[model samples]
Target chain A: MYEFEFVKPTTVADAVAALGEEEAQALGGGQTLIPTLKQRLAMPATLVSLTGIAEMKGVKAEGGTVTIGGGTTHGTVAKEAASAYPALAALASNIGDPAVRNRGTIGGSLANNDPSACYPAAALASGATIVTSSREIAADDYFQGMFTTALEDGEIVTAVRFPVPEKAAYIKFEQPASRFALVGVFVAKYADGVRVAVTGASEEGVFRWSEAEAALSANFSAAALEGLSVPADGMIGDLHGSKEYRAHLVGVLTKRAVAAA
Target chain B: MTKISMKVNGKEVSGEVEGRTLLVSFLRDTLGMTGTHVGCDTSQCGACVVHVDGAAVKSCTMLAMEAEGAEVATIEGQANADGTLSVVQQAFQDHHGLQCGFCTPGMVMSATALLKDNPKPSEAEIRHYLEGNICRCTGYHNIVKAILAASGQLEGAIAAE
Candidate 1:
């Protein structure tokens, strides 16, 4: 790893100020960034450690909304929030493994926005708000593409607020090597309507399958997704699964998720 | 450079390390606690698992400075002061849970923490909880058995001494 300056800021304000420096990255769990740096994929001049900042941790549910601190680990969310958000908790429980869940944070997962990540699908389906230091971004607008996000330089995602759904479920077909999703579906029913988000099978990145959503909205049932075919035009293709396979999986997992919901 | 002061194995230790220094490196190099091995540079392997403030975490995936003022427990701390092995450690040994033992320490630490939180976890729950700690040897059947035996809920099971 390249030599760099380290600053442990005790407050969010201080952490934000430190992050404003040229080529400084906020260290949240370090489940992703540290490995990237060690492999020479990222070379930041400084690292602003956010662990000392007390505010960026915990999970709270109130007023039909669930707010998770940006620094909250997947394991905590899985074990602690299992009763309130079963799908999200189950999704968290299945992430990488116990150690990964212990070290990987929800905010880091969102900011990094890996193409096969599970949290983005959950966020999009739950209609969560990505609250940052500058502004709040809707789940739809937050994700841009694979390993890409709408966050500008120095913009730190502080928390995520998910509106509690009447019912929700997330299901994924994981790639054996990395255990990332090959095709993941998150389904949620709000007071207004049902939302469905798909991850891990898009060349343009995470997207919603409106056809499946429309079908499920009309009647929430597994049979509703029987004939739906997600377009293969911009879906991702890899050795583990072809675009067609992923497209097919989108329907299957969507049906399974709706059934589970 | 970052000056990190934290509790390791119940002792408060302080050190000044580079920003890029991983918590595993800090524990092994600076603190001389080499029990927490680094199996994979990426966060895939659980060889470097440790407890940060009573929660199991991957030390390799975190920076040393991130653990400042936090309580950390490594495999070295699992044994009693009288040199008696921890219940999980004894379980692993008696059940022949490990062969090469590269992943044993981490496996034991993670399982210990799991049992602490959920004392009466079922067999499936034990397997699910240990998904992160991979072992190439023993096929994990014995590891699961060891954890179940250590939990002390199984009637007529001999304690791994």
Candidate 2:
């Protein structure tokens, strides 16, 4: 790990000021950032810790929406959001195991936007809004690609607002080692229409499947997607699975998610 | 360098450490509390589990300075005041839960937290809660037995001990 200055701020204003330093990075949960630092993949002049801000850590559910603070750990979300949004809570409960859930945060997960991450799927499928210190961006405009987002330099995410869906479910084929999604699908049914998001298989990162969304929006059943064929081109292929295999799993899991919902 | 102060096993301690120093190193090297083992450099292994602010967390993935002013409890603190084994520890012994004993501390810490949250968890719950802690020795059968026994859900074997 590289030598750097560590700064912990008790408020958002102080955190913003600390992050303004040259070559400084915002630290949340440190589940990913800490390991990145140890491997010398990231070398910043200062480490701005966001765990000290009391206001940015909790969950509130009311008025047809569930609002969660950016710094709230996965454990808190798993416990608190169970009654209101069981599918989202189950996704949080199953991420990385008990230890990793205690430290990893939703804001950090969405910001890092790993190709295999589960939160991005949930957010996009549910039409959750990503709230930053400056503006609120819809999930459609938030994710750009793998390990990337639309976040500007030094911008801090304060919270996320999720519109409560009539029904939603997330199902993933976990890569046993890291518990990350091999090809996860989240199906959300709203009053207006149904939204389907797929993660871990796309080279372009988490993306919405308009065909499945249209099919499920009309019928809302597994049989509605009987003959749809998802193209295998541009899908991620590695030691875990082949592109065609993942493409097949994508169709299978989407049906499973819709059936479960 | 960063100066951090925190409570470890009911004692207030302070240390000056580099920003890059992990909490596991601070506990093992700086404070000489070597009971928390580090099995993997990555965060996959749960060998370095510890309690921070009354919640179990992986110490290897957090910086030492992030634990400032927090309460931390390690494997060294799991014993009774008279030096006898804790119920979770005794159950492990009574059930022969360990063969290599490398993942015992992490398993115990995770079990303690799980029972605190859900005291009378079912068998499936115990297995789900231990998803992070890996035990290559006993194939996890005895470990699950020990955890169920520790929770007082088992009847014959652990009750006799």
Candidate 3:
């Protein structure tokens, strides 16, 4: 890893001020950033550590919504959000492993915007509100693409607010080596309608499947998804699985998520 | 270089480390505590697992500066006060959980954390909990057995298997 100045700020304002420095980067849990640094994939003159900010580390449920502090670890979410959002908790519990969960933060995961990550699907499907240090961004507009987001320079994701759905479930077909989602689907049913988001399969990153959402909203069941299929085009294809396979898995996992929900 | 202080195995230690120095490097090189091995630097392998503030985390992935004023525990701290093996370590020995022994430290650390959280994890739970800690040898059967035995659920685990 390259040498850089590391500063741990106790407040988000301090962190933002630190991050405003030239070549400054925000460090969350470092579950992904640390590895990237080790590989010399990125280099910055200063690292603004966000984990030390006490106010940005917790899970709170109120007003029919669950608000998760950005710096909150996946393990914390798994335990604390279980009652408020079991589907999100279960998704958090399965990310990487126990050790990874302890270090990986929801803010970090959402900030990285890894296409294979689990949080994006949940955020998008739940229509979450991403509260940043500067302003709040709707999850729908927050995720831009794989390894991309709507975040500007020095902007930090401070929290994510998820509306507690009546019924929700996330089903992930993990890529064995990394445990990342090979093809994952999150199905969420609200009082008004249903939302289905697919991850890992698309090269365009996590996206809502409107067709599946329409069908499921009309009839919330596995049977409602009959004859519906995701297009293989634009899906990610690698040694792990072909694009077609991922597309098929998307459909299959969506059905499973709907059924499970 | 940054001067950082932390409690390692209950010993308050201070050192000068580069901004990029990982916690495992601090424990092993800076403090001469080599029990925490770095089997894989990319954080996939659990050989660098350690307890940072009572939670198991990959030391290799965490910068030493991040552990400032934190209580860090590694494989070197697993033994009892009298230097006897920890319950998890003893069970590993009894069950022959290791062959190459390369992943033992991480496996033990992860297992100990698992048992702390779930006192009596079933075979499936143990396996699921151990997803991060990979053991190329022993096929993880003996490792599972050792963790179950340490948790006093050996009989149930064996029957389930």
Candidate 4:
């Protein structure tokens, strides 16, 4: 790991100011960033830690919306958000393990945007709003690709607001060794319609399964997806699973999610 | 080098470390607290697990500066002032939870954190919580028994105590 200047900012404004420095990166949870650093994958001039900002650390639920500060760790969300959003809370509780849950934040998970991560599926399926230091980005727009997001340099995510859904469920087929998803699917039923987001299996990263959404939105049952199939062309293939197997799991998990929802 | 100050093992300690210095390095090297082991540098191995602000966290995954001013606890702190082992630690010994003893510190630390939060965790819960703490020697059976015994989840073990 390369030596770099470390700065802890107490406010969003201060964080943005610190990040404005050339080649500075915002640190949240440090679960992913620190590991990446240990591998010497990135060398920045400064690290702006958002953990010190009191304002950017909380879980609030009101008016049918659940808003969580970007700095809030997965443990907090798992404990605090259960009443308001059980599915999201369940998803948070299952990430990594007790130790990982204590240090990994929702914001970090979303910002890092690992294709196998669980939060992207939830955020996209729930249509959560990601609030950055400068602007708010819809989940669809926030995720650009694997390990990528629409975040501009110096842009710090402050919080994520999830409009509570009437029904939601997440099913994860995990890579046993790492606990990351081999194929994970989140199905959310809103008043307007249903949204299905699949992760871990895609080459293009977390993507909404519009076909299953259209089917489930109309029928709102596992049986509705009886004959549906997700294409294996763009699915990720690795030691854990084949592309075709992942595609099949995606469909199976989505159906399970809808049924659970 | 960055100056970091925090409470470790109930004592306030300060040290200067590189910005890239991991919390485990600070605890093991700077403070000379060798009880915390680093089985794997990567976060997958829970041998580096410790209590930061009363929660179990992968010490290797966090920078030392990130833990500045936070209350940190490690395996060294698990023993009584008289050098007697902690309940969690004693349970492991009583149940033959460790063989190679490499993963003992992390297993004990994680178990302490678990029992602190949930005084009486079921056998299933013990297995779930031990997901991060790997015990290849005993195949996790004795380790799980130790945690369950420590948590008072096993009636026979409680009677033995």
Candidate 5:
């Protein structure tokens, strides 16, 4: 890691001001950022630590929606959000490991937008709303691509609001090494319809499986997805698995998620 | 350099660290508390696991300044009063949970954290909770037994011969 000035701000306003400094970056749990810094992939003159901001740390559920502060750690979400949103909480509990869950924050996970991350699938499938320092962004518009979001420079995600689904479940085919999803699927059934999202399998990043959503909405069951399949094209292919394999897993995991839901 | 103060192993310690200084470096180099090893500098290995504010985290992945005013605990603190091995540590010894012993500290720390949350984790739960702490030698059978024993779930298992 290169030499940099670290500032911990107690408030989102102060954090934004600190981040507005020339070449300054917002530091979340550092689960991903610290590694990136160690690899010299990013160099910033200043790092604005966001963990100290108490206002951005908590989990609140009311009126069929669960709201979680951005700085709230995955460990907290796994425990706090379990009753309100079991599937999301289960997703939080399984991310990385116990230690990683202790430090990694939902805000950091959403902002960094790792293609293989679990939160993206949850947010997209649930159609959660992302509240930022400046404004609120719908999850549909929040995630732009892998490692990319609609966040502007100095913008910070303060909270995410998830509509509690009638029934939901996430199924992940984890890559042995990183524990990231080789192919993961989240199935959420709401009052109006069902939403299906796939992560860790796409080159374009977390995406809604609309066909599966439509099929499942019409009849929410694993049997409804028997004939549907995700195309191998645009899927991630690496030493872990082939693009075709990932596409196949996406279909399989989606069915599993539906069955589990 | 940032001047930070925190309680580690029940001791209030203060140090000057650079913004880039990892918490493990502060514990291992600044305080000379080397029990918290850094088997893999990357967060994957779990060798640098420690408790900051009473939760297990990868010290190597966290900056020293991030632990400001937080109560930190490491393997050095895992021992009981009067220097006896803690239950988890004693269980590891009785079960022969370690081989190379490189991953013992982390294993003990993670197991302690697990047992704190779950008093009697099933075999599958113990194995699942230990996903981050890798032991290349033990194949995790004894480690699982040690954790189960620590939770007092291993019926008729003796703590010492």
Candidate 6:
């Protein structure tokens, strides 16, 4: 890794100020940043460590909503959130073994917006809000594209607020290498309507599968998605599976998710 | 560079490191605590797993500064000061839970944390709990057995002495 100035800020204001410096990156869990640094994929001039900022940790569940701190690890979420959000807890429990879950933060995952990530679909399906230092972004508008987000530079995601859904489930076809979703679907039904978010299949990144949503809305069953066709256009194609296969998996997994929910 | 102070293996240690210095690097290099190994630079490998505030975490993927003021426990701290192994470690030895041992430290740390949280975990529960800590050796069959045995032994020992 290239040599860079390190600043451990004690507060969010200090961290944000440090991040405003030239080419500074906010260090969360470093589950992704450290690897990127080692591979020379990212070479920032400074790193503003957020560890000292106590505000960016823990989970809170209250009247029909679950607010998780950005620094909350997957393991904590998995183990502690079963009663409030069973499907999300299950999803967190299944994330890259114990070690990854312990170190990888939810905010980092959502901020990085890895196309194959598991949390984005959950965030979207649950109608979560991306609470950043600057502004709150709705889940539908937070993820822009593959490895892209609505976050502006110097802005840090503080927390994710998920509205407790009446029913929700996440189904993932994991890639053996990265253990990330080859094709993952998160299905949720609220008083508003049913929402289906597909991740790991789109080259353009996570997008709502309106067709699957429409079908499931009519009848929340596995058979509802039997004949659905997710277009292959702009879907990610990789060694794990082809775009068409991923598209097929999305439909199938969405059905499974809905049924499971 | 940043100066970080943390307790590792019950010892308070401090270090000066670059912004990108990983917690694994600080443990392995600055402190010369080489028991924590970095198998994969990425977070995929659990070889760098260690306990941070009683939870097993991948040290390799975490910034060294993140550990400031946090309690850390590595494999070196698993055994008694008298050189006797912990029940979990003894169970691994008795059950042949390892082959290459590259993933042992991480596996042990993860199991320790799991058993701490759930004293009497079933085989299926053990497997599910350890899903994050990967071990290519022993096909994880023996590892599961060892955790079960250790769980029983630890409980017995705690009850007896």
In terms of DockQ, the best-performing candidate is: 3
Reported per model, the fraction of native interface contacts reproduced equals 0.94, 0.94, 0.85, 0.83, 0.85, 0.94
Cα lDDT for residue B63, candidate 5 = 94
Q: Which stretches of candidate 2 lie over 4 Å from their true place?
A: B156-161
Query: lDDT by residue for model 1 over B116-140, one digit each (tens)?
Result: 9899898789987887787998899
Model 1 chain B lowest lDDT segment of ten: B152-161
Query: Residue A99 lDDT in model 6?
Result: 72
Q: Give the Å shift of residue A149 in candidate 3.
A: 0.9
Query: For residues B1-161, what per-residue lDDT tens digits would candidate 3 score against the true structure?
Result: 87999999899999999889999999999999998889989999999999999999999999999999999989999999999999999999999999999999999999999999999888889999999998898999999999889999888657766
Error of 2 at A120 (Å): 0.2
Q: What does candidate 6's lDDT look like per residue over A14-118, in tens digits? A: 888999989999877777777788888888898887766789888899998989988888988997788999999999888887777877789889989998899
Model 4 C-alpha lDDT per residue in residues A1-261, reported as the tens digit of each score: 888999988999999999999999999998889988888899999999988999988899999999999999999999999999999999998899999999899888998999999999999999999999899999989999989999998888889999999999999998888999999999999999999999999998999999999999899999999999999999999888999999999889998898788
The alpha-carbon deviation from the true structure for residue B56 of candidate 4, after best TM-score superposition, in angstroms, is 0.8
Ordered by DockQ, highest first, the candidates read: 3, 5, 2, 4, 1, 6
- Candidate 4 regions off by >4 Å? B156-161
Candidate 6 displacement at residue B106 in angstroms: 1.8
* lDDT digits (tens) for residues A1-261 of candidate 2: 989989899998899898888999999999989889888999999999999999899999999899999999999999999988999998999899999999999999998999999999999999999999779999999999998899988888899999989999999999998899999999999999999999999999999999999998899999999999689998999999999999999999999998898
Clashing pairs in 4: none
Residue-pair clashes per candidate, as listed? 1, 0, 0, 0, 0, 4
User: Interface RMSD in Å per candidate, to 1 decimal?
Assistant: 1.4, 0.8, 0.6, 0.8, 0.5, 1.9
Q: Residue A8's C-alpha lDDT in candidate 5?
A: 96
Clashing pairs in 5: none
- For candidate 4, the per-residue lDDT at B157 reads 54
Q: Rate the local accuracy (lDDT) of all candidates.
A: 0.87, 0.92, 0.95, 0.91, 0.94, 0.86
| TM-score (chain B only), all candidates | 0.94, 0.95, 0.97, 0.94, 0.95, 0.92
